[model samples]
Target: MEINLKNIFIAFLKISTILLGGGYVIIPIAQSELVEKRNWVTKEEILDYYSIAQCLGGIIAVNMAILIGCKLKGTKGALTSVLGMSLPPFLIIVLIANLIEKIVQIPNIDSFFWGVNLAVVILIYLAVKEVFLYALKDILSVFWFVLILVLACLKVNPVVLILSSLAFGLILARFKKEVKDE
Candidate 1:
């Protein structure tokens, strides 16, 4: 299907509307919608965009929308994607801000939040599983994954982890090319 501005906007708007928890929860939904259903993007493409998005400053979901939008259309697509991705959340936050205190006082609200938290955890697990499987495609990748996981657990800065991973990947690629040419 030819993805146009309207489709881009609507897709992101829908994603943003039901998006609870954080950016990690977005992975499976985006994969299903854009990759499986719409056929607008590939699994690898979404994963690549998502990885890059995480390394950047802003919200990961919005970063994803911008990257995918730019890929599909261009500057206008990026703007439209941002508007779609942000509008619902902004309005919802505004509405919730006023009523959050009272809303929490209601009976069963605690249970509701508890359930939502559990669901978010499951979603996060699914997202992590997907990315982990995608990333560990080789022995070298597996080595890097374990090393990085250890570094992350030890509280190493994410920027250092990312840069070092990039450097490692480049050197590995260069070595592979030189070996292949021999």
Candidate 2:
């Protein structure tokens, strides 16, 4: 199948419809669909896109879709992807807004949401596991991993953590290069 704007839109639209629990949940589903099933992108590319998406401002799935779409077909692909990703949630929110009062009154809804939350937790765990395995390739990475986990537990803001990690990673890379040259 050709990787065109229409396909990109449809893929994201289908993904957005089934996606729950936001960005973390997108990982496995996207990997299965875009990488394994469609062959539109690679696993490594998805991982890289996911990592970059985390640093960006908007939603993770949408950011990822844009990056992949742009890589595949440029600006039109990106626009199409965003439209696909956004449309479902927009409509769902509008529908919910109209029925929220009645929806809240349903006794079984609490149970339903609780089950969904549990599933989301599992999805998040899977996403973290995939990223963790990809990231911790060496002793230095492990060191940074521990350090970052500590900082996160200490309640440091995520933006600060990411920025500091970027700075330190650059410095370490430069230092490694200089040492190798010697």
Candidate 3:
């Protein structure tokens, strides 16, 4: 049951390479590998890491790599994991940059990318649903969701919406406590 640094790096490398979509697609794979398969962390802990990553100003995959690496192997682990996760994508993008314009110009290649884009959209939607399921378990969460949806549809800044939701949650929690005391 001992997890080593090399294994951790390989796990992240595999995820980074095989994940077809962008950062969000990492969620399910991470949940499965870290929480379910490897038992390196719990579901709640994974969600917490995800939330922290989202709040921070960087890519979720890199943030997650650091989080998981630190959790398993300390600072060195975090560094290696981040490097392992980032290097492949960086190199791939660089290698593809020259060919991308021509590649997209091809009808069959365009069609393939379009299909892949659609699949990525679906994957992102499923990931959002899974993440929300962890938090939206009560009436308050539903109310907050409705509020956020309304605000988002109206083109409000997401930062404002998030802050407003936090304030609303605090107020609701206080009200719930007061009602219980009465």
Candidate 4:
């Protein structure tokens, strides 16, 4: 089925509305809506796109939305999905910023935010578990995970790490191809 801009817009609206902890929390929701319900991409494909989104220089949620949109309908779909995903949060932040000074004085608002934080923690935990379960598919992947984790702990710049990982992967692929041809 052909994807319309309206469809992409609506999909992002649904995804963005329920999202509290940001892009990471969107995984389960995206899996259900985009993969299972809409069949825009498979579980594995979405995960791959999520990884790619993470390595790039933008908000993961926007990147994921664009990747999924592009997968579904190309350039127009990508722009439409980004527009859909961004507007709600932008508007929300604007509204929230306007109210922050007054709202911070209320005890109940603090409690509400604390509750939201707890919920976000849980959602993030589930998303991480799901990602690890799928991502650690082999010894090589495990090795890379450890290496990346260590790098992160050492305070390596994320952009540097991403570029290094890309270079490493390309070199490994090239070496493997050459070895196979030998």
The Cα local distance difference test for each model comes to 0.83, 0.83, 0.77, 0.82
TM-score per candidate, chains pooled: 0.85, 0.87, 0.78, 0.82
In what order do the candidates fall by TM-score, top score first? 2, 1, 4, 3
How many residue pairs clash in each candidate at the backbone level? Answer: 0, 0, 0, 0
lDDT value, candidate 2, whole model = 0.83
In terms of TM-score, the best-performing candidate is: 2
Candidate 4 TM-score over all chains jointly: 0.82
Better of 2 and 4 by TM-score: 2
TM value for model 1: 0.85
Across 39-119, the per-residue lDDT of candidate 2 in tens digits comes to: 998766788898789888977788998998899899999999999989999998988998889988898988888898799
Model 4 weakest lDDT span, ten residues long: 173-182
**Which parts of model 4 are misplaced by more than 4 Å?**
153-155, 178-182
Model 1, 47-148: lDDT tens digits are: 889888987887788899999899989999999989999999889888899898898899998898889888988887776776676777767678878998
Between candidates 1 and 3, the lDDT winner? 1
* Candidate 3 vs 4: which has more lDDT: 4
Model 2, position 142, has a per-residue lDDT of 90
